[model samples]
Target: MTIHTETIVDNGVNTEALIGARGAFTEMPEAAAFTFRSTCDWVSGTESSNAINGYFGLGQEHEREETFTIASDHPAVFAARDTAPTPPEIVLSALASCLTGGVAAVAQHRGIQLRKVQAIVEGDIDVRGILGMDPDIRNGFNSVRVRFEIDADATEEDIRALVAQSQKRSAVFDLLTNPTNVHVDLA
Candidate 1:
């Protein structure tokens, strides 16, 4: 089988390359089957940091590693030392990064030169649920709001359409907006 690949460069983004890879995936769905793995190990006190390391491309042709640290703590009022950002903050960061990436990709694909793209993702959580004060409340964010500030050579309507396209295609957005099954077992 012959595969065709082309490169479309727009402000440092290779739109054709991304499109080519997607085409390849569509041609061979099995090639797109991939499992991302991560492990978090508790390091110190209950309120201390946890070392997180992860890798991608377990069943694919390429692989990469990412490592980071996260902390869990409560405010002084809760009698715990506050260190790094909490887990929810990390979730927001992930969402922001994913959305920003989508914007960049979409702009490149549409041949729009972007000067800047910023995404602000915010989640509102009611602490009563986490504190076990209200069983009816949820233990997660009640709502999430995402706002984008884009500077590009395109009309506002075009930019809005691009953002919509990005949101429609973003994996992270889908993951958060939809239901996913997760299984946990002792390793």
Candidate 2:
């Protein structure tokens, strides 16, 4: 088995662990209100930031089943061909893309020419647990594992170093491995 690796620079900070380190601030946003708009069929509303809207039709037949697409300045595309992405699936995709992009960005910045980058992502989530039907189990994914395939002319050590740097800088990777408080207020 060929062990693919990447190199990384450690700045003594594991960004993943600092998920909620900022805590609360004395001053909040002055507006306390925001707005966003989109014309694409795949995206709309302020929640989407106007880049793309994830769409799914309504009614009982569409419950938990609908197609999703992306409408951006570049192209209108489908997120998942057969069905819409659930909340957890979105997180998985975010991590996968982050690592892939991070590797390419770091390699280019460091003058390393990479031929290709590919990633396979997997996560474990128990529906019963997440639905609160099982009190003894955890509600979120227990763990996530990613497999990356990279094509570069660098040596084993060089590859390892690059991968390490990508991991350290990957924002989504940090979010998953870290804990944060999500507050929801209903008016």
Candidate 3:
């Protein structure tokens, strides 16, 4: 049996010959790496679209099988059987985590040994407030109160100084209390 191949011709010229003549010179330029550095503009922005697969290291198999993603974590934890964690709970978690790390960093910097550090964070957000029913009431948490129990041997002054420094230096805390601008572009 004989096999036949068709030759590509353009204007009575062989296409392959033309391409070979062009060689590497006709190829497109090489691509370069595009690097970017970004900073968070919001202190307590709730992260969305993180596959509702459980905690760290848990794969998609653990995620919700339903089309309607179920909320877990804060307010959701406190809500009824069908509800999910609210935005306030996420905020409280961020603050609590920041405070814990800040205290630890300050103590480490000052050469103070920490026996234990505990914090109780209480935040109250009116359901109606979040629902946007009343214009006079705040939409978010009315107030976030934190009670810290430091077990370090350092004096009260030392603890106070550490807390102040942490509050001043923490990026998330600053974002929460300050104004931020957001820019968005669609391709």
CA RMSD of each candidate after superposition = 6.0, 14.0, 22.9
lDDT of 1: 0.78
Q: Candidate 2 at 115: error in angstroms?
A: 0.8
Candidates by lDDT, descending order: 1, 2, 3
Query: How well does each candidate superpose onto the true structure, as a TM-score?
Result: 0.82, 0.57, 0.55
Off by over 4 Å in 2: 1-82
User: What is the C-alpha local distance difference test score of candidate 2?
Assistant: 0.62
**Per-model C-alpha lDDT, please?**
0.78, 0.62, 0.59
Task: Output candidate 3 Cα RMSD.
Answer: 22.9
- lDDT string for model 2 (1-187, tens) is 9998885534233444333332312133323222322333433321221233333322112222433443222112422333345557677888998888777766765657777778889999776885589998888888898888888867768877878898998878888888867666754
TM-score, cand. 1: 0.82
* Backbone clashes, each candidate: 0, 15, 2
The candidate that wins on lDDT is: 1
- List model 1 lDDT by residue over 1-187, tens digit each: 9999764447777777878888988888777776655456555444656555544342544433745666665566655566656678777888888888888888887878898998988899998998999999999888999999999989999999989998998888887889889888986
Off by over 4 Å in 1: 1-9, 46-58, 61-78
lDDT of 3 by residue, 32-130 (tens): 122223222222323332233232221112333533332433343334342345556657777877887877776765656677778788887776765
Higher-TM-score candidate of 1 and 3? 1
* Cα error, candidate 1, residue 3 (Å): 34
